[model samples]
Target: MKTQKAIYQSSLPSNTRNKLVLRRTRKRFNPKIFINRTIETTAIVSLLFTGFTGAGAMGCWGMEIAMSSRNWQHQKNICLGMMLVSFSGFLGSALIGASFSIQRDKF
Candidate 1:
């Protein structure tokens, strides 16, 4: 009973505990610094490419929705098709984003 009480007392509030863990963990595993400018530039370019492509996909989806909403008969089919396309874009964006993260060693 006394040992259990001690353990309970040692446990911190959830927020403070999480912050402490994060701070300590970050300090332990610091990221590597790239020596070449082109490495950084390439990472930035990759990020931009992925971001813009994903955004463009979403924009096209938006246009489809807007165009489709005008009619009742075609709207349902168009919206369903757009929704499927958006879901695919979401998955593709996730994969592309992961590739960028892998290259940057951010994940």
Candidate 2:
């Protein structure tokens, strides 16, 4: 079996045998890409949260409708609040994503 160094060196030309192999440099942190990724993640998470809370609110409202008691009012209110908050977050993130796309296109 060939050694790892010998396998790698076998592919190079004879003229380059004495030259040093330069490794690729690491990329610098880009804030624009980071911000775009963050916005995309936030949008997806908020959309999922909104869907869950909206379903909960619907379920609570359904229970309230089927039962004669008003015990689900507080829970329904909480669900509605959470749903609204998550929906707003989703919208805000979506808007930010759109703005970023527009900015990228402009340059």
Candidate 3:
């Protein structure tokens, strides 16, 4: 029995052991929230757009303007927030667009 436990313990790498410990510790102390796949995908797409726009804005307008006019620590954060907003907009538009694009057959 001792040997079985020893073998099991030895099989886990230190990083895996650390991660398991961290998970257990977090479960005891925190309320775990998981984002659904659709939400995650939407966030990613939004962020991508936000980043693209923000970077384009920065290049066109200059970082100094972003820093002086905005309180965001970096242009990146501003970009991220814009991304989230765009994502939300896109998610709504996609749902509507999808509904419109669907074809129904009438007998």
Candidate 4:
């Protein structure tokens, strides 16, 4: 059986080696695609966070209403604040996505 090093050492022709080098060198970074994907990912994550926080806020509000407790009221306020922040994040990401889509169409 051929050893791994021996197999690896079996040299290719110069043309094939040059082709491989050229292929490696041809890769390029695309900022537009990268930014679009990043915005999309942020939008998705923030939307999820908004959903979760909104649910928590509703639950706290319901408990405060049912129990008439000041502690629950405070917790409900905090949950509402978190939900609002996450919602804002989702909105910002959505705006960025929309702007990017428009820019792409223009170009």
Candidate 5:
């Protein structure tokens, strides 16, 4: 019981009775880690692309249903907008990915 108490006290860093220091592997700080993590832009852009594409798909589906009912006039504009946005999002993602690839290759 005394040994157990002594061990417990030693485990505490601030304990004055039996001193024990817990050492951990220290990783050197790197500026690159901060810069790399701070601007995680790819995820945001990918999510934007996903949302735009999903909205576009919904718009196209709406247009299809509207056309079937012969109410195509109003849906035409919306559907077109959706398709355009979807196309742009897909194009943008592709371009961004390509640009990154090119940059990696260049250096």
Candidate 6:
């Protein structure tokens, strides 16, 4: 039907996707092969890690809020742990950004 055809069309790969490409390493698992690219990858991974950790922290915070009604110390501890993890992830991301900033500069 028309709706099915529309869905199929929408599912097709985007033709206007980002044209920029990440530089590849000369050798697999070899950071020296592409020092700049290695830093780029590290920064990207750090960002992803921070995002996941932040999400976890948010969930823990929600749980803590729910348990606040019951005055449960366990939930507070769990939330604290998650917040630490999130903070660590954010710190890691910041470190990676500071270390690899030169990689993002134009030649």
Model 1 spans > 4 angstroms off: 1-73
lDDT: the better of candidates 2 and 3: 2
Which lDDT tens digits does candidate 4 get at residues 51-107?
Answer: 888888899889999999999889989988988888899899999889888887996
Put down candidate 1 lDDT per residue, 19-64, tens digits, no spaces: 4232212223334433333345554655555565556556656766
RMSD of each: 15.0, 6.3, 15.8, 7.4, 9.3, 15.5
Q: In model 3, which regions exceed 4 Å deviation?
A: 1-48, 54-74, 103-107
lDDT of 5 by residue, 1-107 (tens): 11222233444455464664334444667875554443346445645765765566576567768567545544555655665665565576567666655776896
Query: Number of the top candidate by lDDT?
Result: 2
Question: How close is every model to the real structure, measured as TM-score?
Answer: 0.30, 0.74, 0.31, 0.70, 0.37, 0.40
lDDT of 1 at 9: 29
How well is each residue in 1-107 modelled by candidate 2, as lDDT tens digits?
Answer: 32223223546789987676654445668999899899999999999998999899889999888884577877889999998999899999999899889988996
- Report the C-alpha lDDT of model 3 over 20-102, residue by residue, as the tens digit: 33122223323222323454566567667866876755663565565564543455466656766896767775674455345
What TM-score, to 2 decimals, does candidate 1 have? Answer: 0.30
Q: How do the candidates rank by lDDT, highest first?
A: 2, 4, 5, 6, 3, 1
Error of 4 at 98 (Å): 1.0
Worst 10 residues of 6 by lDDT: 1-10
Model 5, residue pairs in steric clash: none
* Candidate ordering by TM-score (highest first): 2, 4, 6, 5, 3, 1
Which of the two candidates, 1 or 3, achieves a greater TM-score against the reference? Answer: 3
Best by TM-score: 2
Stretches of candidate 6 exceeding 4 Å from the true structure: 1-33, 69-107
Clashes of 5: 0
**Candidate 4's TM-score:** 0.70
Clashing pairs in 2: none
Comparing 2 and 6 on TM-score, the stronger one: 2
Model 4: runs farther than 4 Å from truth?
A: 1-26
